[model samples]
Target: MIDLAPHDETDTTALKERERFAQILVLFGRHGLKGLAARLGLGAGGGEPLEDTRPEAIVALLRDIGPVAVKFGQILAMRSDLLEPAWVDALSKLQDRVPPLPFAAVQPLIEEAIGGPIETSFSHFETEALAAGSIAQAHAATLLDGRDVIVKIRRPGIERIVDADLRLLRRLARVAERRIPEIARLKPDELLRHFAESLAREMDLSAEARASDAIGEYLKTYGVRTARFDWELSGRRVNIQERLRGFPASDLDAARRSDLDLATLASTYAQAILRMIIINGHFHADPHPGNVFFLEDGTLGLIDFGAVGTLLPRRREELVRLGLAIASEDTGGVVDILMLWAGDPDVERVRLEEAMAELIDRFSNVLLDQIDLADIFQMVFAILRDFHLALPPDLALVLRTLLTAEGFVRRIDPAFDIARELAPIAKELMRERASPARLRGEAGKLLAALGRAVLSTPNLVGQIEKVARTGSITVSIAPKDLERLRGRERAGRGTPQLYPATLAICAAIVFSSQPLLAGLLAFGAVALAVFEGVRRR
Candidate 1:
């Protein structure tokens, strides 16, 4: 997270800062949120005229305030778990489009970055930008070897502009929470800090280049690949990567006109992204139309790795369980998972369960393919809001990413079902759970834990003995631990004590005389000790 200078760390009283702060207030006032501005300590709190406060007005306000504000709104758009449909829709459609900066403006920086001149790296260069966003712009170019590449240059002087905006926003958030009681639910300060960190990652062109390499692949029929980067020429401010081939994924006309099988592509794209999220936990958070493409090679290509979502393995498991519970109409299970997510054990279980049962009943007759996820998400968020519980930020991001992806995928093939992907995904998830590799990993973990406990047992036993001596306490081992009670069962070569083990060889050899039973006896002893060690642990 970008650490903003507190009052003591920097000169908050600087004139340049004061001017920028006033300018932000003026921009908000111009956008018809003068009351909001006043509440944020911009002006007198009462007796102020404010214009339209509709969703569109909010979008316009952010866009007008510039890149930082626009990016913040874009992040908020992904928070369907916190926002109503109208606001999320309006903000989701909000674009961070800015007029391209002239190549002449960035030529000096590019030449210095490459340690020479543009001609030294590129034989052919297009001055015009391939695309322009709030943070950076991409230019098409060709290397001396006749390879097509894209050069993304961070906007010059953007750091200064963004730094100023962040400081102003931070100050405003601190005061707004106090002045406007309702704004506390939004947790403005934390959101602003997170936005700063996300923007910082996006602003670093080289970081975006590295992220593309880590993005996972889907089924062979399912998808495409990321652009290859040139690390030699890439840096924090400038990135050069091979250009990819594809039509924008959101272009329905292109999807229909091409020979590509929309049915297969739709499911593949849906499942591929879901696997990235549900299976691997790292996924492209912003899969909006502009960031995804249907490749000329008959595959779905994804780009723009600046924003991504991550789900913890534990959370992913809960999600799977929640999905299963919903599908099976296990109302109690659904309520249990929801309460766990809500993190409130004392919540009214009956009320939550009744609500889940109603939700399940509402969709019970509907086929999985026909159920509207958008509608379901809205109702669920409403329930969460009613209970005064907010969805975790990561889960919120997943919901938004899923909904965003589903929007474009359906645009290709309307009948394609996202729910259909879940069953297969869940099957794979179950298979993974029972896979031998996973079982071995679990066993190894258990063994390690038992080993640790056993190694520390002497110290624990000493403390316990001391405590027991203080009182006339009784100590007894349970029946399950009776094997451990046999302390004198030695397995040495010439030992007198009998080796006790369940193995037939040891059982027979100990009962009947046998010399080579040492190995079997030792194996049986260690196995029993480890098993009991784990049980005690």
Candidate 2:
């Protein structure tokens, strides 16, 4: 028997809320509500179809599920590939319409997070939230020293609810993995782990503050100034940052009024994204329109550093190679780079090659100026889907951000092409391949790897001979032993243990036969054994 009871005092309310939500699911199912209602178990009760005209009912159900589900729906809305357009449109409304926590309830949280009274920390503060998102809300305020800032406070009880929901989700994911073979292809368990990490980061305001400061410093190093919030007054639950007064980038009317060059601004923004990816190897994972602003001076302001993407040095290098391969229309090179990054050499190389070729053919004839970023991205995503390639989470986030930024840029300036803007950057990166310093470093690395392999070759050969003579091998198995063994067996043409077990059974059969028949059976067994050994080797 599993204990489903709440573990802490703070979790009791969340547990009750979840039970209520379950009841609501049953009621909705009983009334024959929407399809999603049935999927959510809201339609568990048997009843006549109910009228679906109640938008309020839908909103109420979402609110009852708490902040994490609301946020999930909001993000799902952005993934047009995952849901119907109508559903996406409906969920987009959730962006600005999440119910705001009461003003009285919010002030105390701010004071508690910052310590002491709200007045002591801020010269003036707005009681009402300036904006309300699923996880947190931002309020306008002025520091005691007179600096304008915005204070972001996490909604009360959100962390508790999120933890409960995620625990349930993780359990569900494990069940899904066991029941669905296709789910393993997508790595549902790893995806859940990623979601947990992202949610945890979002809940920690201190982490976001550090990310913002790091990005700001990186930008400054490149002589690019962007809006960043002050973290001196920030804490785990509260983030106080310099208030930025700017129009949303999507506001075309304001751009015109301010005489901002949409094309130049789009180019600059695209460049900044490229820099974040290629130079720093760290980038804002979410660059949706709502998270970016355009100031009157044409400086782009990026906010919400909670979600970020980071690539390991090796992956970064592979990405550089991939970018070059794309630019040069080298389909084979692109496929090779993808295989290296995938960490699975036995994956269907032919399928990957074909996918890469098709993707390259789609844009091969198009000039950089004529290539729309969205179209290129759609082709790449199509290829990924066709090949069933699972991208690393961080890499996937980077691609999503780039796609979103391209869309935003296109909306602002119809003629601004992100592909064209990135062409020169891509060319420069490709040129790095031939740079003397780069070539020398590559040579050194290659020599060092070869040296290590050469030194180990004799010992490896000796071990192989010893194993062959002894008919046994002593291998230290680690946590990933099974996966590593499977890979080695596939690559080395080695027989799995099951094959040897079958051979042993054949030998037993021969031994049990009569003397005359046994001799013939022994010959047959030897022949089968030879064939099996030759096939395996």
Candidate 3:
């Protein structure tokens, strides 16, 4: 089971830093992350380090570190374009299951969040939790209005603990940036910022409720179902949503007994999700089997909106183009979409196109119905990483979501193909792109862009002309490099201060062991100091 023990103020105080450091060191060493420990400056003066590079060791290490770290691993796992495939594969297996806290621990929090005693607010509230995750616990409750609901309460004192962990994580990211040059391309600090942002959003139950409500309303348009929440009863720490009574999507036996058509259900799920991404530009980031329910009424119910992904309309269009390009073996088109998505990056166009060509060649011959979208996308991401191209967090999250959704669909129906499922959406997007209205929109956008460029041309020309005349340009120092330089300067300035301390230590050591040598050394030291001082003057 995962560790869910609450850490108090004492655990985050400066006094516990050494203990925390030691814990990190030991865990790292135990899990073959000793290289990281050494990079973090904790491996010296140690026993034989475990240097195993198994991906499982990495997952184990993250899981052992608790919720925040696990979430970090999850975010990293989704970044296939920034990480090795093995690491991504292993981290994908990290689960957030933790033992439930005793009912008494969160009882007061629930009452306080809804502003009353539990008895007064609910017709009946179960003391036993229905489920417990790392951050929160959900209880089966009936509202005072006699409606069934799920009461979710944040774990007491978790915010303080997560905040402390985030602080340490940022520090470690800085350390990694300074020490691990190879990992610098991953932009650890920037990644941490994304994680922290998502984490903060997740910590607020109200934000999740709103997200759920929005997605729920959106899903209804597609005839999909999700649990509705009582926004009035929801607060930052507490959420009361309708309780879902359905079997997990993976429960094929239950699905069959309920006369559910697995194929139709899978198709419905795929269509809804694809439309959510391609049309709505918002989707559930985590759509694994556990979070998906096959309701008795033949519709799927999505739960847990804590991790939602949103793409801009432009990005959605680009993604649609990317799909169609891959389908048609348009290598140049693939590279073009990728370049647009990746923004300004140092790219070898020929090499990237060649890689895309190879990717197309590999999957081109495969039948559409047999195409594995997740595998193809994974390979594309791998090649992107090879070329040092990184996807923004939004795109990474989208890819992660699609991959996860594919995994769930394939688990119960191996014959189900993600590419085949996405083809209709891709075709629709293509149709829309070719429509007269879209054409007018595109033409107008282009003209507006040209107008803006024309307006800025004089300033651009002036800057270029100035640069040409000056024959030189000043570049600002990077903060990381500046910090390193300052550190070196400090070390240089500290050398003289160490001299007197070094002499005193040497004298003490010699005097304690050999009085004759101590006396001679003391005389020599005093004479050298006097001569050096006179020379300086």
- Number of clashes recorded per candidate: 0, 5, 0
Clashing residue pairs in candidate 3 are: none
Q: What Cα-based lDDT does every candidate model obtain?
A: 0.73, 0.65, 0.76
Total colliding residue pairs, candidate 3: 0
lDDT of 1: 0.73
Candidate 2 wrong stretches, greater than 4 Å? 1-64, 73-97, 181-184, 221-225, 340-348, 431-437, 459-537
Question: In angstroms, how far off is 470's CA in candidate 3?
Answer: 27
Error of 1 at 97 (Å): 0.2
Instruction: Give the number of the best model, judged by lDDT.
Output: 3
Q: Work out the TM-score per prediction.
A: 0.77, 0.73, 0.78
Candidate 3 lDDT over residue span 276-328, tens digit each: 88788878888888789987677789988988888888677677667677777
Model 1 segments more than 4 A misplaced: 1-13, 47-52, 216-223, 342-349, 436-537
> Model 1: per-residue lDDT, tens digit, 317-342?
78877877798887766766776665
